[model samples]
Target: MATIKDVARSAGVSTATVSAVLNDSAYVSPPLRARVLAAIRDLNYSPSLAAQNLKRGRSQLIALVVADLANPFFSRVVWAAEAAVAAWGYSLVVFNSDEKPEAEQRILSRVRMLSCDGVLLVPVGDSTKHLQRDPDEKPLPTVLFGRTVEDDKSDTITIDNISAGRQATEYLLDLGHTRVGSITGPLHLTTGRGRLDGMLAAMKSRGLAPEPRDVRSGEFREDAAYSVARSLLEQQDRPTALYVASGLMALGAMRAIADLGLRCPVDISIASTDTIPGIGGLRPRLTRTEHPLVDMTNEAVRLLVDRIRRGGEVEQRNIVFQPSLVVGDSCAPVGLR
Candidate 1:
């Protein structure tokens, strides 16, 4: 194994010079830098990240923890974060909390110990037990992504679900839908609950009471969404519009609608969240709420890097993105028969 000393000797430079060149700590002559690079290549020397972190008291790695990797929303969020972090010369480490506070806590502890630059977490629940809740003692620069809870102080980046939900339903209302329903994700997650709140708010605003029986909660999976939607479609007076909280769930909702010999705008209208781009092809472009994950991620990374570069106490900041409704063939003007 070629050590720093070996590279220094081969490059005919002092160990300190080699260190500065590798870490970009200080300006090194181009010739000297070139020599050091050549030596490193010839020796196949890899810089010791641990040692560098120890010396600087911080790591150039940002940890992003998500509740569920299965959710395309989270996946897209991570993808956006990755793109943004690299621009600032920082790397990202993705952790799947798996909706478990215990796992989230373990990962938090590990990230803290590793002296990571910062952390972006989508908390499983409202309580951040895994992370010490005090902003003054905030062990690190941490931002909560997509999941908002009790801690308003921690940096949060999420779309206003309530607003999005309201918007989705309002679109259906504009299309002459009076009996509107919704399929939400787990009530345990804030996103799910918040979206539900939006649906109710929209209904109330329009002088219609959102029926509880019409609303269903699922695991944010296609199967659960499918079964729930199928059951709903079996009702005597089925809902005219369904605000599906996810793109994946929309697929199930569409399938259920198809099974019942229903058509969009003709029978039931759908307004879903997150295009997800790849997995499923939503025909004629389903009316959807754009999550703005790419933009949110850019801000998250910017905040993380800023916190690391500029010394500051643990402070909570929230950046809420407003979702845009993309009108498509999935929704239509209801026919009064």
Candidate 2:
């Protein structure tokens, strides 16, 4: 069991000098660095992991917390972030908050215990206060992803959910879908509420009422959306077109429509968000509001590392990217309607 003391004793230098060398601090001279390396090699003195971590002030570890990993969008974000983090010589600790603020906060506490450099969080808005270690100052550099920072709170990196929602609805509108319904995610989340706002804005612009009955709420999951879509179809009259909150939720809605022997853009039309890679391979490619999950992840890691370099620096910044729509097989113009 070799330690810093042993390395120093063999090198005939102070323990401080050995630390400077092992941690790759620039203060040590080339001669001193060479001597330390020589001694470490001859003595087979392995640097203590705990000592190194302490000296570096960080274990070169980061945390990425998201709402749902099983969802394709979340998975793509995690993948992109992990790749970018590794390039900066840091490893990532992944956490699935399961859309629960309590779970996200619990993971944040554990990250605090470790020598973590920073965190990328997609918060559960209603319970977001749970993720805050300090109301005024953050205990670690954090980037809020796909979510908004609490008023004057953490830094943020988000896709324009509102714009995305607006775009989805506008696509339907351009196709002459005047009677449109929406299956929205629970309004407790910023993404959910923001997207819904966009939908309403588009409707209002067209001089239409954002009908209360036309919009129903569901958890941002497949099953919940599926059930809602089924209920919409059971009514005596249904919308000519529907806009769903998330891509995964959209899949469920489509399946429900299929079970009732309805057709897309023929019997009914769909415009929604989130498109997994698998969607391209579907017999009918899905039209969608496509967020740049990978790009957003890269930016989040970049911002976190910059903040970490400044030692948990304070800066209130928000990066919001707009999504684009892909007009695929799922939607059609209303001329045939």
Candidate achieving the largest TM-score? 2
Clashes of 1: 1
Question: What would you estimate as the lDDT of candidate 1?
Answer: 0.83
What TM-score, over all chains together, does every model reach? 0.89, 0.90
For model 1, where is the 10-residue window of minimal lDDT? 276-285
How do the residues 35-85 of candidate 2 rate in per-residue lDDT, one tens digit apiece?
999989988888765766897677788998888887777888888988999
Clash counts for the predictions, in order:
1, 0
Off by over 4 Å in 2: 9-14, 24-32, 38-46, 131-138, 312-314, 335-337
lDDT at position 251, candidate 1: 82
The positional error of residue 334 in candidate 1, measured at the CA in angstroms, is: 1.8
